[model samples]
Target chain A: MSYNWNWDIFLSPTPSGESTYLGWLLDGLQWTLTLSLGAWIMALVLGIGLGVLRTVPNRLLAGSAAAYVEVFRNVPLLVQLFIWYFVLPELLPTTLGDALKQTDPLAQQFFAALLCLGCFTAARVCEQVRAGIASLPRGQRNAGLALGLTLPQTYRYVLLPMALRLILPPLTSEFLNVFKNSAVASTIGLIELSRQSQQLVDYTAQAYEAFIAVTVLYVLINVLVMFGMRLLERRTRVPGYIGSK
Target chain B: MEEFDWTSIPGALPILADGMLITLEITATAILIGILWGTVLALARLSGNRPLAWLAAAYVNLFRAVPLVMVILWFYLIVPTLLQRWFGVSQSSDIRMISALVAFALFESAYYAEIIRAGVQSVPKGQVDAAFALGMPYHLTMRLVVLPQAFRNMVPLLLTQAIILFQDTSLVYVIGLADFFGAAYKVGDRDGRLVELLLFAGAVYFILCFGASLLVWQLQKKYST
Candidate 1:
């Protein structure tokens, strides 16, 4: 049994002649990084808010935060992407829906995918944040309160700074996961790395080479992030903290 | 801008329910196979054999580092050919489900291996020493003393991972198998009621996963003692 192998197809220009196949993939890589980093910013902000709310004394706020985490975390990312892409625009008022529809298609897909991934990863990050806060000594909160700090100020000056540092290791994993999870955006036509590979396979019929290239890129991203986080962890480690080692 | 129609759901439920079964079947089979495979990997990593430990670690690391969707796509493209050459199973028969099952199980085993390894390590070393002191053999000590405690400690984690696996089962749609998510997408596209059908699908997924997570929380509480 024999099969044709073409390692050089990526260098060949596409039928459109605008760019080579490798250019399309690099463009896809650019989008993947952009989307992942974009969504990660959203996840960190929303997750921190929700996580703080979960630890607050107000039952209503905490309950709502918990509910948000439960709903978002339970649904699959692909399903959520579909909802954001196809269903959400229609669900809005006609003026809003029409405005969204009138926007460029790629922009719409990018926004929908970005929001979907942001919200989805936010749920996971919320849990990590909650766990980090909860693992702190109860007296830490009390000390801040006793020191005349308001609740918000306490979280800002006392609880959160320590908690964030404590959770860096888990946060690193979550960051890596966001990059990996960005692949689901391709289902919504976002043209990220996985979709680019699929398109490469379709145009070139080089399934092995396409997928292997995508896999290597993914690994490279993950490894780079892992080492970066390890260095950050080492530099920022608190003496006698949980992950100081 | 169309009127939000709820009636399309009932018409779509039966087909979607069939797809849900396929999703559930794939998830269950994968969880079982993954746990079995993960247990072996966990033991091999702990077995003090350098090559075996390296092999298990490499497998876990490679699978963990890559996205599950890519793994599914790879298996879809490659597994059938390997299956045919090795087992003489013709490619004509429906192999999508089998390929999905194999991919999910293998991909998930990496995660499960880490969880089980942690669980095994959580068991006190003294217990193994005590078992050996009782003249129990290595396999017997592991089977009778270590594994039971380790599994008990890890039940909640295992269940949580299973729920994650259930959600990920939707990725099988890439291979064009009509799992729950695929069925919804197809029915939505066919009838132009994508909004209603997909909303319904998301709700179903939410309920199942939320319910399972609640069960996992309860298990954690129960086992915390």
Candidate 2:
């Protein structure tokens, strides 16, 4: 194909001599992992709350939850990321805004990315959570309520435990999506895995090797995540439900 | 502190609309090509031939595993060299647009493949058997009996994906193509109104995507009923 494929560039140090290109990629991987994991945690907590809210008997809570999901889910994620990174600071109180604007640039980027990816994914997660809960028989909720549990207790005790297991497979997809979506953080200059690959291309002029390396890293992450989720599903499976038996 | 200076927006609408056209063009091209190629991949995954199925599965997995931004960059950086070498196409903007289009189609195809595969699976086993009983060939069985039913069940999903694709065209901004979001960003940056332009763009995106999803929900209800 006439391409000058140099697999060794990764071993060579950058002109600045601080670290090798491989080290650069590892550094990028660290940020990617941190951003995605933090966002996942946030998405889970918020999504569960909103999802639970959507299914509750209270019209206000359900309507508000639906509103949150629609707003976050509808916008393109890149746009949301941009708003979080570029526009958010301006809307804050002046002193607070200045404080945010003046923070360590990387931290600022990371926080913005975390918030954007977290909330955007929370919207999708909320839908999955709502659907999971809704798929349960009406008798389960009614049974819980009749047995002297409050609504929130019903969720914590009777509803979520069962519904979460039922929805684990779909939840796995949403989890993987957070990792994938974290790549968008690079656009706001987070220097995540994808950004590092772009930097490598600019520096080394080996676009194929750089992108291939990044692609493999991403696949590795996806594989690891799927494997982990599969393990979780097995551990949490109740016999006679969802092919468990 | 002060009210949003939407003053620049009035002057920028024409350029933004130009950018929106590019966005729509990219989205349309990607959906058409992605669905077609995705169906091929779906069928291959369901094919009896082991190696062909494996190859298609591997391709879909690889694409699905990676993020869209990376795919956009991969094509943006990789394809231009080939385009320039073979077609003598050297305009950077044209190359970027083409690369974005290719990237979205290829990436979206992987996703569409999974959706289409699920849709195909949703068709009951008896339909294929009955079609075979009628002496229909494999292709005709898929065409006349299975795919129509599968596609009916899939329309809602396909529309959902298309909305996603429409939203995703914004990711081409990574390559510096002035799609709607990119154009808004450029104007905002130029005018020192990045916040206003971005908020405006977000509002526009919210309205369109939200509207489209509601329509899909209605379609889903109809089909399910």
Candidate 3:
């Protein structure tokens, strides 16, 4: 039961000695970054569209958008990932399904993870965007109408810019959530950092060291993300308005 | 073409029901322990003692940064070895379950502490000052004045955290605990009813999560309004 507590095993040369563990970790970090960036872009685009739709003043469009947000937001990401990876291809047409199934499994899994993360995060983004839009003063829209600007123009030139500035902090947090949630992809065989750490632990029997490295890596990445967002926040701060505590 | 067998429901019902109980137990225990520990951590973080705050912060950061799957795996696979080596006691599956619960509770406490801290911070400074003016001791004032109001205001957020903890209980499956999802996978694997079994499991999850959402909605309406 007594482990020799070999810190040396973690520090030593890799078993194969051709590829270091740091190399594996860096590869995993690349996938993590790739997945998060892809997912964030999709989420932002779809979320903005859905957010605008939710407030379109048309009941059906608004209600449908609301439903989308509710369903995706309420479900757990892990379950959604499972359904996306395992069931969606089977439900497709034969030719397309076969093509999807025959595609590189790793790529397919990564894409599925991206899709699920994007869709799931989109729900939250929709809510944030809606709140941002709603928090706008009523007079802005009225002034836009008074100036003979169209509704879309009001949203584009006036409302969205100001609203986005107001909601930047929350949006940043949502982005962070998206990044963290990418770890869930590791469950489905994606070679992300968490999974890579697990593999290293399995091989080296150095769970403590492996996890410590993983934790430090995560904290570092998250801190860097937060710092960058803080700079963005300051850059976008409204001139006259003092930020509330 | 194999006809979709809808008739598995009657037989699967009892088995799935058992799994539901296990799921509920895990979720309930996690929430209970998580809330208790989380509250303590929150208080510690908010305490004036610098070292205690730092220690609490470190604990929170460590757990929150690591994925829950890793935490559960550590508890199930490594903790047993560590326990035997350190204490000379053999560990059982039951003990493993307890370890999982402890690990999850500790992890979740970090999040809950943040939530609770936010709730506490939202309270007006004048209220605490007013309590102090009345000559109430710090601990008594916190217990009687601050926490009750903070907790009351935090009902919606607390429910949200509970829902998350409930969902995360699925991570126990990595350690071979036969919770709802694990049961469904087992049933599917046994009969090659993968799609059907998963759909059934998804329905159960949706129901539980949706129910939690409805409860939260009601609570928000009742408490906030």
Candidate 4:
């Protein structure tokens, strides 16, 4: 009740006098968006491949994909981020490790976070992709093969088109999760939105305002994503199946 | 390029184990509180009272939209001030665990509510009608007839969420709480062995989560049969 509210702090420059505090937050937002979008793209591509592998006739391929999902999904994202940032360089071949370590600190942080988020999310995305494929009737696969298509062609033309549509909704949630989970990158010092807000609170001593703004920004991102996904879902919807309107 | 010094890790087990206990405590409290409140939110959303339903939906949506770390920070920073004003708490460090608990529970309820709602809806229309025809009130029908069946179907999902909550307890590190991961980091930093300690922590997390997932898988398999 006694705390001072400072709405004007956004326009104030940082202690180092480079940019306004609002500028700091916007930069952080940019990092979050890029990190998450980059991760989502990687996750989607890898997830689809691994997902297909899990459902494939080759037991070896399916087994390896399953093992990948288990390893990635079981570890916490924060721990995975740590492993990427801290442990990875040491384990690599010396020249490569030294090259990675010698990169600009910001690039190092960004790449580490990107790799961690991409792989962690790919695991979840793989599960959804698997579920989506499994939900399709057996006839879909059989019919495609019966039409003289090879397994690869059957998957490309017959399976993926329908399975991707079926998974649009769950995939959207995973996409949103990438953004939310990107906040963990701050632990390794990425200066993303959450970290920027924490910095704002630390500098200005205005905890309530800092967090309220960050919370609103996050909600806005969620609303925009859900709205966009709804449009995608409506367009791709299959007849007689339940879907978002 | 230095060889991993395995010496310090054995000495730190007691400390790490202490931290792990705290981690499990937070996870257990959050799971209990999250499920209890999530059930209420689910019921309210389905309760058909417009104002109550809208409020419940808004709570769930607002929490779901934000990152868990933000919620944890908000509670850690803001609640202490409120508590100071109302309860005259001088030192706030002692209650960081409580703050983390409240944040996780509230944040988790949103996800759990959606799950519970779907579970409740999955129960057949005939079941609700039969309960009503037997002269049961709406609340009793839900409590006695609908929820039991819904809960049976929800066990595996609820366990999966619990596993996630267990993993997420690591986020308490943001507040400087010395949970298992935090303990590992600290000891690692102190001993100049960050790599070894982090690998150890990640391994422990993997073992626990992988084991729990297998358990959940078995439960789901049983349910399907």
Candidate 5:
């Protein structure tokens, strides 16, 4: 039962001796960053739109927006990713489906993954945004109305900046969630860090080292994000407000 | 667009029911084990002993940082080999399920620890001091006074964590378990009804999570006020 542990496998060059393991990891890291960034941008935009719709005076718009949030927020992201990648394209019109299928399958699937993750994350974000906005005192909105600022103007000028600050910590955590959830895209064959590590493990048969590397990589990214968000929090912190000590 | 097939559900009911059972089992097991393990880790984390706190911290950090899929795959692929080497036993799917449970429990413990620790900390120091003044032992005070209050305060957060745990059980499918998501995929793959099957899967998840949310809302209303 005595097995030789190969520490060298992680450090030493691969048999091909051309591309370092670090290089492959960096490539995967790049894709992970790309996917997260694209998805976060989409989530923020759509989340705000939906959040505002949910809060609007219009009953129909608010009700529909509420339904959208509930549906998306409740469903698992993996299922959504599967549907977007496997099922949605098939349901499209024949010409469009063929075009999507024929166009670089990897790229199309990657885009779909981004969309699904974005839309799903957006539901949570919408909830956070709505809570952020609602936590504001009613007088602020009333004062805005008194000053003759339109509904959008009041939100843009007074409510949003204040709410953004109030919601920064939760929003940061949501961002972390989006980053972790990018892993789901790997199930559909996206070459993100997790998938790349799996490929490496499959080829090299070094499961432990592969997992350790992936774990370290994820920790590094999350720590970096936590630090960045802390700095942002301090900089944007409202002066008079006291956070939970 | 293809016409909606309401009839397909009746035909698919038995298979869907089977899938639903698997889903319920995984979700229930993960919730129970995850919460139990998480509570222990949370208590260890809050213990004044530095070594115990550090151990709990490290556990939480490692699990929370890595993605659940990686954790599940690590267990699925590596645990069997490790177990065979160490224990001289063959691994089975049940073992894999146990491993998945362990991995998820370990991973979720950190989050639950944080939440529970926050709850414990939020309890007024005066309460503990009063318990001490009344000559209650520390452990008794914690159990009788502090934990109950903290847990009561933690109801909503706990339910939210439950919702998260239920969602995460879907990752078990990677180990070849026929949970709801996997079942839907199997049905779709077999029937060539990808869209219909996916929509149905989405509906199933919606029902579970929505139901959990409603239950949590009721608990919050009952407990918070």
Candidate 6:
């Protein structure tokens, strides 16, 4: 009860002279969005590839895809981020390692976080895609083949579109997870939203305000994403499909 | 690349084992507590009590919206002091673990609530109507007829969440608790063989979670009609 509350800490000039605490928080939010967006793109691309590979008839291709999912999905994102940030550069060839080490610190952190999140999320997305594809009728693939389409063409023209539509809900959840998991990047010095809130508390001691503000921002993002994905689900829904409503 | 050393691991195992114990303890405790609270919230949501439904909804929304790390930090900072004053329990050695448990339990309840709600909904409405027609009271109908079936259906989903909870226990490193991930981090930092130590740690997590999830996948396949 005796604790003093400071709502104006955001307005106070920061010690770094760049901007106030509000700016720092916003900057952190920007990093979070950038990291999540970048990771999502990577997740979709790699995830779809791996997902497709997992479903392919070739034992080797499917095995490798399953291995990728097992490796990336099982590891903790924090551990993976550390490996990416610290161990990976060292594991590279000496010249490449030195080059990575010499890059600008912020860019280095950014890329490390981005790659870490992307690959980690890609595993979950791969599972979603695999399930989606698996849920389609066997007749569909047979139908595509019966129409004189090559296997690749059949997947591209028929199977993938239907599967992707069915999987949108799970895909949306994975997308939201990327935003939430981006918080782990702060451990490796990425300065995203969670890190910024921690820093704000350290500097201003307004733990309640800093965290409440950050929480609200996160809720806004989550709500927006939920609504947006719901709209997409409605737009892309196939009539008579399961879960269309 | 430098030559790899494997000897550091055996030396670190005892500490790492302790950390693993903590991680498992937290996961088990949180799952139990979270499921209990989640069942209550799910029932409230389904009970047609508007105010109770809204309150449960808000808790679920707020907890789900925020990151678990923030919740952990909030409880770490806020709860111990309150407990100390209110309960007169001294700030004991297990405070960190206690706070982590509370936060994980509370945060995970939101997720569990959703799963339980879905499970409850999956049971046919006609089942409830039959129980009512048989002169079963509402509470007895839920407790004796509805809940058992709902819980059976929910077991796989609950286990899946527990697997996720196991992995997330690593995040306790943020608060300086030496859970499995924290143990690896510290030992790695101390010996300067972070690559080897972390690789070993990642392998342990992978084996445990991947194995458990394989079981879940099997169960899901078995249960699916």
Best by DockQ: 2
Per-residue CA lDDT of model 6 for A49-141, tens digit only, reads: 889999989999999999999888777788888889988888888888998899899999999999999999999999999998999999999
Worst 10 residues of 1 chain A by lDDT: A236-245
Worst 10 residues of 1 chain B by lDDT: B89-98
> After superposition, which runs of candidate 1 have C-alpha atoms over 4 Å from their true positions?
A242-245, B90-92
What stretches of model 6 exceed 4 Å from their correct place?
Answer: A242-245, B221-225
List candidate 2 segments past 4 Å from native: B84-93
Tens digit of per-residue lDDT, candidate 1, span A83-179? 9999999989999899989999989989998999899888888898999899999999999999999999999999999889999988998999888
Residues A1-245, model 4: lDDT tens digits: 46798988889999999999899889999999999999999999999999999999999999999999999988999999999999999988888999889989999999999999999999998999899889999999999999999999998999989999988988888988998999999999999999999999899887778788888999999999999999888888998887743
Q: Tens digit of lDDT per residue, candidate 3, span B1-225?
A: 233565666677777778778778877887787778888898999999999999998888777666677777667666666677788875555766677776777778888888888888888889899999999998998899999999988889988888878877777766767777777777777787767777777777777788888889987988775
Candidate 3 docking band: acceptable
* TM, every model: 0.97, 0.97, 0.93, 0.97, 0.93, 0.97
Candidates' lDDT values, in order? 0.91, 0.92, 0.81, 0.92, 0.82, 0.91
Candidate 6: the clashing residue pairs are none
Kindly list the per-residue Cα lDDT of model 5 for residues A126-186, writing each as its tens digit.
Answer: 9988998899898988898789999998888988888878888999989988888898888
Best by lDDT: 2
Reported per model, the fraction of native interface contacts reproduced equals 0.74, 0.83, 0.19, 0.78, 0.64, 0.67
Can you give the lDDT of residue A206 in candidate 6?
Answer: 89
- The pairs that clash in candidate 4 are none
Candidate 3 lDDT, tens digit per residue, A28-95? 88898899989999999999889888877789999999989878866667778888988787778777
lDDT of 2 by residue, A1-245 (tens): 68798999999999899999999999999999999999999999999999999999899989999999999988999999988998888888888989878889999999999999999999999998999899899999999999999988999999999988888998898999999999999998999999999999989988888889999999999999999999999998877785431
